[model samples]
Target: MDAGLTPVRVVGAGPVGAVCALALAQQGVPVCVLEAQPETARGDSRTLALAQGSRLILERLGVWSRLADVTPITRIHISQRGALGVTRLDAGDLNVPALGYVLSYAELAAALKQALRDADVAVEYGIAVARIGASAAAAELATADGRTLATPLAVVADGGRGDDAPQPRFERDYDQMAVVCDVQTELPHAGQAFERFTPDGPAALLPKGDRYALVWTAARADAERIAALPDTAFLTALQAHFGGRRGRFLEAGPRKTFPLKLTWTGSEAGNRVVRIGNAAQTLHPVAGQGFNIGLRDAWELAALAGDTPADALGGAAMLAAYARGRRADVVGGLGFTDFLVRTFSNDLGPLRHARGLGLLALEAFPPAKRFVARRMMFGANG
Candidate 1:
């Protein structure tokens, strides 16, 4: 509430929200972040595959160095189930330090929050949003505690929900659950990340130091069964499904499961509000693009706002520009991930043969491998 300070309001304190705040605050803009959670938690078991572009954003925010000790993804391996060929990509191929880094979600969030604190961004914690309304001049946000705050622009980083918001949307439920957990392996992962497409779903193993973080997508019933298995039993099941790609699965840490879905929000320009991050789109995690895409949205919006006048930050003109800039990337990413999930998550004979052949072709062609590598390291949108 300082005089002469340009005001921007952001909801949610997860990665996207935190990164947006950091980006804006770094550019000398005053930002207020409303987070429902009181205190940022640590040791969030969810692991994230940070693309090279995402790393650059974090580095700009002064967060990558603090996360270096916990983030490591030196290589990536992709293959189709029951297929004879596999493609491998190393950071050396791209001549980059590393293709990407895998870090704990909670750790990254905490790091960003700390950076925000150091940058003096005001964060109102433990307050839930009660209602939101926007006008041409400013956005009014009412918290559950009955406090109303107004700002020139309001960015909703909250996860997907279809309500009275002005943004039009498209959504699809995959009827799948991603069962995630950290596991201890007998062999070192050697900083290699695995994306294995099986009949049930796409399972990813991301390197986390001496162990691996597992994201297994499967039917709800199967996910429930897998979640119920004992540590040793789960390891056996995992070994049977994953094979020796990384190494023998020794033991698993805590396990959790959540439904997977694909969502997209239409342009929010005509209306006086803008939705960024997961609120704008929630992608299937099969490609590890969910958080990466969200971060890109946040960074791009922040950059646009920083380059524009205060009065232009969240206005129709600015929001329209943002929507136009983000549309292609968002649609393409959603389509690609959804296609892979549907193509690989079944045993249909024709589609199976086609997808397997596609994988083989990519393995045989160096350029194809490079294209996939580039897309994974730097999103097609980036």
Candidate 2:
């Protein structure tokens, strides 16, 4: 088969998969994306915080300008709930235009969908993947609609699967659910994102225009109870937990809940298959790094595919190279998010004091603050 005519088959139409398809198509690589749902299907309404690095990737892919209107995060604040001190990070401090931007998941999907259409990438919505098989020559994907796609490379961005594959797996269950929603507060957020770690879990308030996006990671029971609260009751509960940081919470929007866990899939070299995004790893939402890291995977893999020789596109050597390129980032991000969730989620006296002191030190010391800021804005590599 002619290399230029051969397309890459991507499973899933979530943000990660769509992003991979878009990046590859932009590089003149043909792509076929299979989505299990219709194009009009409503996506999860949660909000995502896009780090500076993620913003750069979207800008390179030509989708950031269209999303500029809805992206509102520019600063971040970190502290324990009811703590006397808070550490703040500003985009200006790092000499960047913005630390990060907050985007609604649905809006981002819409933007990427439009970009994919404009690029003329092939997308088959409402088609489920029945099975996947691969060999030395090409990978094959069978869909529920009776369509078989043969491609040089098969990238699974659909998320982690139970069946066996080439990659090693590492997982951790937090037994927590992240309850997310929007809140209207009496005081302006001033575009500052706040993260407070309590014994229950980590709660974050990210600024979005006049309102704030609230992500509270709590025990399953607590998450359920909180999700069931009436708007007035929810506000009272939120104020009690969040304290007076953003003043009193006035009203809240609909709430949603999702389980929290950490997962990582090893790289497969000789199977003519590669997994990116959620298929590769899933992180705790405390640091807001899950989707951002997946975006990096998409951009990096696309770059690798664009540069590799036609005969080597899905070859063992090429796949291994890609894996090597992504290993540091994948491991580092997973470790960081894991540590943040475990370290902050505890109320042990000694650990609490140590964490509080650490925060104070980070605020008092510019070097330490800058280092943390750099890691947050960039990745481990940066």
Candidate 3:
């Protein structure tokens, strides 16, 4: 396979795109990666919660050992504010070393980039895809600099930000904002993550190094107010809301806020262009499903492409199979996260009582709990 005439072209050099390209290249498939941003500007400060399955994928890609500042989550605690509902998920139940991991987005990106370089994959940074379309023979792409290229398959993993990317077939605006920061609790995290559902939204505290990565969800107005508070005031507010589960929050890092939404580009893989990762679906961050599902999308696509002959890389049959294969996992993840956001983020009396009972039941049933845990750690197929 010629490097210049790669059969597959992947857009976006983010975690998903990098993983897809690296996985394919490692499997003896020639792949070229186009990144809209320059290498120096690709650092992302956001924290990512990667499932155990995702760790396996990275380990297969040979970048897992290169990641720095990673914190493993051995258990997860689920509860509802002002309710009797409480459930805990432990990695020991499944005999896994950890349920998930927390690391900076930039660290993962760095590791993947290093692996790609070592694999001799061609990655052209700052080469934006201005337009992309597919034909029976190949997928055509128009670059921002007026250069045109074609490949047997074009994978759009740029989080649906490309110009020619299809409009989201399903769109939602949750009218909530997630205020994200790192906070230090008086007591150690002990490798436990917490998800506390409140009337505003769901707040997550994932153990990250010496501090906990905090995702405080709230209504738009409330989130704005919280984001603008001084460090001391913010810590006080977080302490009041998150309760004493982790003891008092002593120190805080800079905070940022992002609006919540669910966006999906449908499951129809049109022509030779297949959208995966965030380009395929973007879910609410309730259960940390979005990024991990994107990783699975990348890995599965790479595996399917590797098995298929080069001449039939982006054929209708192959694309269709990819879509069908991913439908269950993608839809299940979307539904699970959306359900949590809708069902638990409110304080309605009837639903609150029902949710409490449901949590109690889930805790009491080992098999059912294990099923859900595996689903989160892997996917619907797991």
Full candidate order by TM-score, most accurate first? 3, 2, 1
> Estimated TM-score per prediction?
0.95, 0.95, 0.98
lDDT string for model 2 (342-363, tens) is 9888778888888888888888
| Tens digit of per-residue lDDT, candidate 3, span 170-213 | 88889999999999999999999999999899999999999999
Q: What is the C-alpha RMSD of each candidate to the true structure, in Å?
A: 1.9, 1.9, 1.2
- Which residue window of length 10 is worst by lDDT in model 3? 1-10
The digit string of per-residue lDDT tens for model 1 on 192-219 reads 8889999989999988877788999988
The parts of candidate 2 lying over 4 Å away from their true place are: 1-4, 82-85, 161-168
TM-score of 3: 0.98
Segments in model 3 whose C-alpha atoms lie over 4 Å from true places? 1-5
